[model samples]
Target: MHRNQGLYNYLNEHSWQITEDWYKLVNDEDSESIYSTTDPEIIQSLKEQNQDYFQHLHKLFIEKEEDFFRDFKIWSEELAKDQKHLKTPVQYVVREFMNSQEVYMKYLKEYFSLNKDNVALDQFLSWIDLVRRVVNLSIYIYIEEANRNTLRQLIAQKEIINELSSPVILLRKKIALLPLIGDIDTARAKIILENTLSQCADLRIEDLCIDLSGVAIIDTMVAHEIFHLIQALKLIGVRSTLCGIRPEIAQTAIQLGLDFSHIRTTATLSQALDRIIAD
Candidate 1:
């Protein structure tokens, strides 16, 4: 059994060489990727980040497996959160990781050829395995973090759309209009309920006209949410009128055993507005 002291020394000494070789072959032509940037600062930052990754990865040759991976996680997270890397398409990032891995493997083979008499075959294979693990773990962590970023953005966008879709436009002093549009799923229905109540309270609305004419579909859950919204408004001392109820929506509301006896109903938004003005 041969100690891999020589392998470790070689990797540490020539780490920068590995980074340079990897950068030379990096495929950065993708228009949508951050790698395609022409800014010299961004290009230099990319090089520094890649070199840092190599700095953490090559320590696997001398450090305990647990310690190596622990440090690698930190590096992977920083890379994942780097604004530039995050903007780069994940597939392109993955391709570059593989390219860097190839560079390391090439260097390892070079080192082996030069010290073939001193390095054992099994030690060489073990080193290969360690290098592969480092690259694989790096890819795994980066992808995981990227997915989390994507999910957060989606949630934020959904919240914004929900807030905009259920806006309470002020018609007059203490009078507001909520014109529901698009299909309403349970999730969106919940947001609508919360936002409508909040906006009405904020505007100190006395009467709210909820128009559903532009709404394409209102499933059982959504119909129930609308009912709850009117009920919630009454609790806040805000009166609500149902307007522009399409025939299908009306049927769905009726079929769901929704009680609207105490609520005011109108055939169109104009009629609802007229009634609000009269009151």
Candidate 2:
């Protein structure tokens, strides 16, 4: 039982005591019998209610604390496995949080820190907010990595297309060799040009061998794009060499009056490689 005088003194600084009428917890329900009793019963009843409220509050505070650590533990484990999934700023924030000595230090400290001298309830609440941010940051990184993996799969597909662009006895310089497969249409041509040009530029390669070995037809647009890429390469100081143009491409080239004079032509990738290697 809280002594009326003592309980009042102990809770003198507490806002709950001042705002006693505001609480449904303490004032809720029929406490009239308890509130009405004289002497020891009234005081005892109020103390019991106070104690019960304190007990419930204390338990909730403890559970909240445990829950904070629980969230932190799960976040830490996942963060350890996937840090890149975290926000760039949050990484530093977490590092500071973990390195705090007055806070949860060591590995925990390195992840987060708080100054002990300024330990206040508000500060503790802020720390929890930061902890939640770190967890969210880790989740973001995980999603980013997952998205990147999917993109990589698509990139691998492009790489495969590049390989087929040219038929070769050998592959060199990480060129996106595209041996034309299936439909050799205008759409395919555009994709090839864009992909090839992008790879060549990104790689900063001087020599690109585009072998039309598998092209079903030597269409007007395909020839135009090939020459276009060749010119783009020259402008960028990259040299594009055509290889594996069967009789069909030659005939089409002649028929279209397409000038192959500025472009180097090779019968096969082997010949192109040999010439490039020689140069």
Best candidate (score: lDDT) = 1
lDDT score, residue 92, model 2? 40
Overall lDDT per candidate, in order of appearance:
0.86, 0.52
Instruction: Summarize candidate 2's per-residue lDDT along 1-279 as a digit string, tens digits.
Output: 111232223333342432333222222232223333346764555454433333322222234556644654454455434333232333343332233212221222222233344344454455455444544554455455555656777898976775566332225664435455554665556666676666677776777777677676766777777777677667867777888888976888898887888788899888888888888
How would you encode candidate 1's per-residue C-alpha lDDT over 1-279 as one tens digit per residue?
323667778888998888889888876778889778788997888788888888877777778777778878887777778766777789999999999999999998999999889888788898888889889988998899889989999999988988999999998899999999998888888888889889999999999999989988776777678888888999999989999988987887778776777779999989998988888
| Each prediction's TM-score versus the true structure | 0.92, 0.38
The reply for model 2, stretches above 4 Å from the true place, is: 1-170, 173-176
Q: Could you tell me which 10 consecutive residues in candidate 1 have the lowest summed lDDT? A: 1-10
lDDT of 2: 0.52
C-alpha root-mean-square deviation, candidate 2: 19.8
lDDT of 1: 0.86
